[model samples]
Target: MESDKMIKPTVSYHLFLYREELARRNARQLRLSRTKIDITEELISRTVKNIKTCSMDDLKAVNRELVFKRKLRNRVSKLRKEAKLAKQ
Candidate 1:
């Protein structure tokens, strides 16, 4: 009777941790998926077409912003890769 009580509580505690970790992993994946849509090849080409046809200053501003943003993204990606290598 005593071992049964101890084992049941321990198992329940581990199950609780497992559920918490699964929830966290799912939330992180959801957030990353949203980021993927904003920076795609299709979005780039569409932007270029808009810049050609668009006279609005705001649209042109967005095009220039994406240009510099891509450069920054490249540097950040390289740094992240270097950090990952250092960790291993």
Candidate 2:
């Protein structure tokens, strides 16, 4: 009878701790999910704002400028590499 009483309280204490841990984990997961949702919403809003601000032609012109700059940058780097090889 004494052992049974001790065992029952011990089991109950462990069960309580387990439940508390599970609740904490669940709360943390819920918080993280909420944060993810907020970030995604912000990104979508920013993308929509950008699309609204720029006309199609403006966007195309900007893209073309970026492509031309990239090509020029690549050419410069290639020239630098060739000069380095010639030195060696």
Q: lDDT tens string, model 2, 1-88? A: 8886665334335455545656783543333333333343434444456876878875675566556555555665666677689799
- Highest-scoring model, lDDT: 1
Provide TM-scores for the models.
0.35, 0.38
Query: Per-residue lDDT for 22-66 in model 1, tens only?
Result: 578454332333233233333555566766676677476666667
Superposition error at 21 for model 2 (Å): 67
lDDT of 2 at 34: 32
What's the CA error at residue 75 for candidate 1, in Å?
4.9
* Model 1 residue 36 distance off true place after TM-score fit, in angstroms: 4.9
- What TM-score would candidate 2 get against the native? 0.38
lDDT of 2: 0.52
The C-alpha lDDT values of all candidates are: 0.54, 0.52
The TM-score that candidate 1 achieves is 0.35
